[model samples]
Target chain A: MNATSCYETLGVVRDATPEAITAAYQRCLGELRASLNGPNPPPPERLDALRAAYQTLGNPAARQAHDAALSPPTPAVSADEGERRPYPFAFTGEGGEYFRIWIVNLFLSLITFGIYSAWAKVRRETFFHRNLTLDNSAFSYHGNPIAILKGRAIAVVLLIALSAAQNAGPFAYGIAVLALLPVVPWLIVRAFRFRAHNTSYRGLRFSFHGTYRQALTAFVGYGLLAAISFGLLFPLFYRQQRTFVLDNLRYGSAQFHCTASNGQFYGIFLKPIGLALAGMFAIGFLTAAGGAPKLLLPLAFGVGTMALMLFLLPYIRVRTTNLVWNHVSLERMGFSSKLAVLPYFGLLAGNMVLLLLTLGLYWPWARVRLARYRASCMSLLSAEALDSFVAGESANAAAVGDEVSELMDIDIAL
Target chain B: MIAADYFDGRSSRRHPATLGLRDGTVVVEGDFGRRSTALGAVEICTGADQTLSTIRFADGAMCEIRDSAAWAAELAGAGIGADAVAHAERRWHWALAALAGAVLIIAASYAYALPWIAGLLAPAIPQAVTQSISDTVLKGLDGGLLAPSKTSPQRQQEIAAKVAALAGPGQLPPHRLLFRAGPTLGPNAFALPGGDVVVLDELLALATRDEEVVAVVAHELGHLRHHHGMRQLLQSAVVSFVVGVYLGDVSTVVAGLTALLLESRYSREFELEADAYAGRLLLATPASIEPLIDTLLRLEQAHAKRRAADRGGLFGATDLLSSHPDTAGRVNALRAMKR
Candidate 1:
C-alpha cells in the first residue's frame, strides 16, 4: 500500500529514534538499488517518495514542523504576562583546570610535530563550549579532528607556497597573491558554516546560511574601502559585515536578526577618537599656558595615552556588544548585554599586567576571568521557555576553510 | 541511580531521566518511556573536572549528567575508569611532564634537525631562482643604502685581480665581484645567493695588506662554494614557518622575535663553516690563515669602538644580537684548525 505520511514511507513508527530512522532509510535505499539492477525496476515515483520522506524526516526541525502540521493545534498559553524573564549565562571553567588542559594540549601537539594540533583545537573548543551554560543547559562542539587536520595540512602547504613565491621573483609573487584573491570570499563563507554547524545548544545546532556572493560583498567589497579609508568608514564596514554574518545565522528554524544601524557602529567608534583628540588638546593647552611642570609633560602624555589605550578597546567592546545583543533577536526571544566599560577595562588592564609579570603563564587564568565576566554580563530575554525550539540540520563544511582563514590571521569574531 | 537530562537526538525536547546499571545493562527511565542497552554498546564521554559528561545510548539518545563528580564516582564504583585523555588532562604531573617533553623536543630539533634539513634542501633550489633573488636584493641595496664605489680604479683593479688569481680558473658557477661605497655599513664583505660577492669600499680602505683583502674575498668565495646564503634563507623560512604554525598566527610580534633569535643562532654555525673554509683555502695558497684572523679582529675592534661611541645606537644591532660568531671564539677555532 502507498503510504501517506513520512513515517509510513520510512516504515517506522512516529516515536522512532533518529538511529532507527537512519537505519530504515539506509535499508530502503539498499533495496531500491537492488530492484533497479533487477529484471523489473521500480517506478521513479517510488524513488521520489523515498527521497522526499528522508529529506523531511532526516532534519529534526523539519520533522517537528511536519508533525505539527499533521496534528491539531494546541491552545496557546500566555506565559509572558507583558514581562520578559532574564536568564543569565554562566561560565564554570576555572583557570587551574584550563591550565592543565592547555599544557597537555601543547605537549601532545609538540610531540606530534603539530599533527595533534587539530585534536587539540577540538578539545580546547569542547572545554570552552561545554563549560558555558545558559538556562541549565551547556553548549557543545562536534568538530571532527580528522577534517581539521586535513584543513591544517592544506593551509600549511598554501602558506609554504606563498612564502616560497616571494623568494622566487616579483612576477611569481604577484601571480600568487592575485590567485588567492578569488578564493578569499569562498573561504570566509565556508569557515562561518563550519564553525556554526559544529556549535549546538539544547540539541539544536546553530547554522550559518551566508553564501560566497554575500561574503564577497561584505568582506571584500566593504573590506577594501574600510582599509583605504583609514578608520573613517570602518564603522560602516563593521556594520555590513556583522549584518552579513548575523542575518544569515539560525537556531533551528528561527532566524537571528540584527537591528543595530550603521549610526550605532559609528557612535561606538567615534567616542574614543573624540576623547583622544580632546585629551591631546587639553595637554597641549595646559603645557602652552605654563600651568603644568616641564618634567610632568611626558609623564602626563604617557598617562593620558595609557589611560586612553586602556579605555578605547573596552569602550568599543562594551558599546558594540551592548548594541549588537540589545538589538539582536531570535524569533520570539531576545538578548541583553549589560557590560560596563570601566570594569571591563580594569579587568583587561589587570590581565595584561599579570600576563607580562608572569611571562604569559597567566594566560589560562586571564581567559577564564574574561569569559566569566562576559558571561555574567550577558542574559537571555525569553518570554516563553527554551524547550520549544527544534534542532536544525547540520550543513556539510570542510575544516580547511576555517584553518586557512586562521592561518591568514582573519579575526571573524562576534 | 543518577538523574540526568536526555535528548533522543531526533528532537530538541529534553526528558528528565533516571539512569542506572541493571545486571550489566544500562537503563534510562523517564516519563517518555524506558530504554535499555548493554553497557558496552553505549558511548560515554566523561569529560574533565567541572565539565559536563554525556552518555549516548544505542538508539542515539544522549543523557547529559550535570553532576560530573557524582557520575565519575558512580562509574568508578562500577569498576570503570575515566577516559584516557581526560585522565591525562586532569593530572598535574602529566601536564608538567608534557611541558618538559615539549621543551626538550623543540630544543633538540632547533639544535640538530633544522640545520641538517636546511643544508640538505638548499642545493636543490634552482639557480635561476637564486639569481633573481640576488638581483632583487642588490637592486634594493643600490636604491638607498649603497652608493657607487669611490675607490680609485687602479686599487680596485689590482685587488680584484689578486682575488681572482687566488680563486683559480675554470671553476663552475664562477664568482662575480661587485664594489659599493657603504659608509653606513663600515667595512663589510658579504656573499649573495647567486655567487655575487659584494665587497664594500670601506673594507679595502681598512685593509693594510692585499693578503687581507684576498682573505676576505676567499671567505666570501667559501660562502658561495657551500651555498650558505641560500641555505640561510631556507633555514629562516623553515624556522618562521614552524613558529607560525606553533603560534597559529604569523602576525604576532612574538613569532617574529622568535624567528629572529633562532635565525641568529643558525647564522653562527654558518659563520664557523665559512671560517673553516677560508682557513683551508688560505693554507693551499702562499698566504697563511693569519690575514683572515687579523682582518676579523681589526673589524671587531673597529665596530667595538663605534659601539662605545654611540653606546649601541637604537638602530644598531648589538654584539649580543650580531649574526656572526664572536671574534675571540672564531680566532681560537681557526688556530685549532691550523694546529
Candidate 2:
C-alpha cells in the first residue's frame, strides 16, 4: 500500500490524472456507503477521513502540495530545526509605513471616482499579509482587481434592485426577500471559496471544498429552524457552518479540522445577553429598594445593561476565538490561541478610544495594533514543516459575492 | 553568486540553489537539478520588500531570491523587470507629502467637484424616483408630527396665487404650496425633492408682512426650479458613498447612523445656490429684495427664540446658526445685487 498522504488516503497513485483522482474519491465514498447499507455502518469518523482525503486530492493546489511533500527535492539543514517548535507570528509593519500606503490609496481612490478601490483592496490586503510573518515566510494574497470590480458592479446592481423593491411597497419587498433567500447559502459558499482560494502560505494555496448542498443546509435550513425557535437554535447553525467551512479547508494537503459543538457556540452567544438582562434586573432591584426616582431607575438600568454588554462582548469574543482556534488542527498539528479576555477587552476599548480621539487619523495605527494582537495570540504547533505541501487549484472567487455583501453592508457572520 | 529557492511549478518541493548570471544565461544549481535558462526566458518581478524578488521561468517554475543585490543588478541592467530596490519609496517625508496630497484632494472635492457633480447628476435621476422619495418622506412626517395647516383655506389660497404670480408668464413653478403644523420640524420651511414646498404654521407665524410670506414662497420656488432639494440629497449621498468606501466598515449600526447624519447634512453651497436663485427672482419682480432678507433674519430669530423657550424639546440640536451660512452674508449679497 502506498503511504497515505492524500493520494494514498484516496487509494490513488502518484501522478494520477484528474479524472482518476475523481474516480478514486467516488469509489472510496461508494465503498463506505455500501458498508453502511450492509448493516455495519462504518463510523462517521472514517467517513470524515475519506471526505478530507477527497477534498485534498480534488483541489489542484492541495494535490500539488501533497505530491511535493511525498517527494522532497533535497535534504534540509536548518539552524532552527529541532523538534517542530511553535512558530510565533511577528508583524513587521510600522504604522507610519502603512499610513503612507493608506494615504496614497485613499488619494488615488478618491481622484479616480472610486474605480481604484479594487486596487486599493488588493494593496491593503497584501500589505497586512506581508507584514504578518511566521516560519520566516509571510502569507500572500492573489486576487484580480478587475474581477473584484466586476463583482462590485454585480453587487451594486443587486443592492439597488433590492433597495428599490423595498421602497416600492411591502409586497415588492416580500417578493425580493423570497427571491434572495435561496441565494444566501450560495453566496456564503462562494464567499468562503473566494477567500480561501486566494490565500497562500509558503507558495501553497488554501482551498475550500464545501459543496452547495452542504452550504444550503448549514445556512438556510438551520436559519429557518432558528427563526422558528425564536433564535434559540442559531447556535446549532453556527456550529454547522464552522464545521462545513473548517473541515473542507485544505492548506496544501493537511486538512484543517474543527470540532466545535453546538453547546459551546450557544454558551458564547447567550453569555452576553444573559449578563445584560441580569445586570438590568439587579440595578432595578437596587434602585427600587433605595427609593430612587423613576427617571433615575431607568438611567441606572440603561447604564447597567450597557456596561454588562460591554464587558461580555470581549468575554464572548475571547472564548469563541479559543473555541475556534484550540479545536482546529491540521492533521495532528493544532492551532492554539492564547487570547485572554481582559487583554482583548483592553485592545477593543483602547481601539475605540483611539478611533474617537484621533478623528480616525490614527486608523492605520489601530489596524496595525489589532493585527499584531491577533497574530501574536495564535501559533501553529506541528512536527512537520509547513512548506512541504503545495496545491495548484487557483479557484478565483467570484468577486461579486464580497461586493454583493459589501453593497448590502452586511457582514456574513459564520 | 546569489542564494535562491526554486520551485519547479509542478511540485511543492523547495530546492536551495545558487543563482549566477553568465553571458545572458541564468544558471541555477541545487541537489534536485542543475538548470540553465536564458535571462530573457524568465520574467522577473520586484516585490514590496526590497530584498524579496522572484523570477518565473517560461515553464512556470519559480525562483525566489533573498538579499539578491548582484543578481538583481544584472537582471535590472538587462531590463528583466524593474528593480525593487530602485523603486523603494522615499524616506519619512513621503508620508507628509501623502498627507498633504490627501488634504488637498479632499478640499478640492469638497469645495468644487462635489457640488458640480451633484448638479450634473441630479437632473439625470428619474423624476419619478425623486417624487417617490418626496412622497415617502412626506407620508412619514404626516403620520408622525405633521397635521394639516392651521392656516385658513383663504390664506393658503392667497399664498398659492402669489406663488403663481411670482412664476409669471412662460415659466411654471415646479411645486405647489403645502402647509402643515410641524411640531417636530419646528418653524421650518423647506422644499422636498419632488417640488413640494412645505411651510409650517410656526414659520408662517414669524412672517409679519404679505410681501414677507411671498418672499418665502418665492425662495421655495427657486429651490424647485434648480431642483436644489434633490441636488442636496444627491450630493450628501455621494459624500456618504465616499465615506463608506474609504472607511469600509458598514456592518455596524453605528456606521448606518453616521450615514443618516451625513445624508441630512446640507452643504453651504446648496443653501447659497438656492438663495441666489431666490435673490435674482425677487429682484426681477415687483417685490423688492428687502422682504427676502427680512424673512431670513426673522426666521433665524424665530429659531433662536424657539430654542431659548424649550431646550428640552425634540429638536435638541439647535446649533443651526453656526451650521448654516451666516444669514448676514446671504442678505448682504442680495442687497449688493439689488443696486
The model with the greatest TM-score is 1
| TM-score against native, each model | 0.82, 0.80
Q: Which docking category, incorrect, acceptable, medium or high, applies to candidate 2?
A: acceptable
What DockQ does each prediction reach against the true complex?
0.51, 0.33
What's model 2's overall lDDT?
0.73
- Give the Å error, residue B157, model 2: 4.5
Task: Give the Å error, residue A128, model 2.
Answer: 3.0
Scored by lDDT, the top model is 1
Worst 10 residues of 1 chain B by lDDT: B314-323
**Pairs that collide, model 2:** A60-A392, A60-A393, A61-A391, A61-A392, A61-A393, A62-A391, A65-A389, A65-A390
When only the first chain is scored, the TM-scores of the models are 0.78, 0.77
Give, for candidate 2 chain B, the lowest lDDT window spanning 10 residues.
Answer: B83-92
What is candidate 2's TM-score against the reference?
0.80
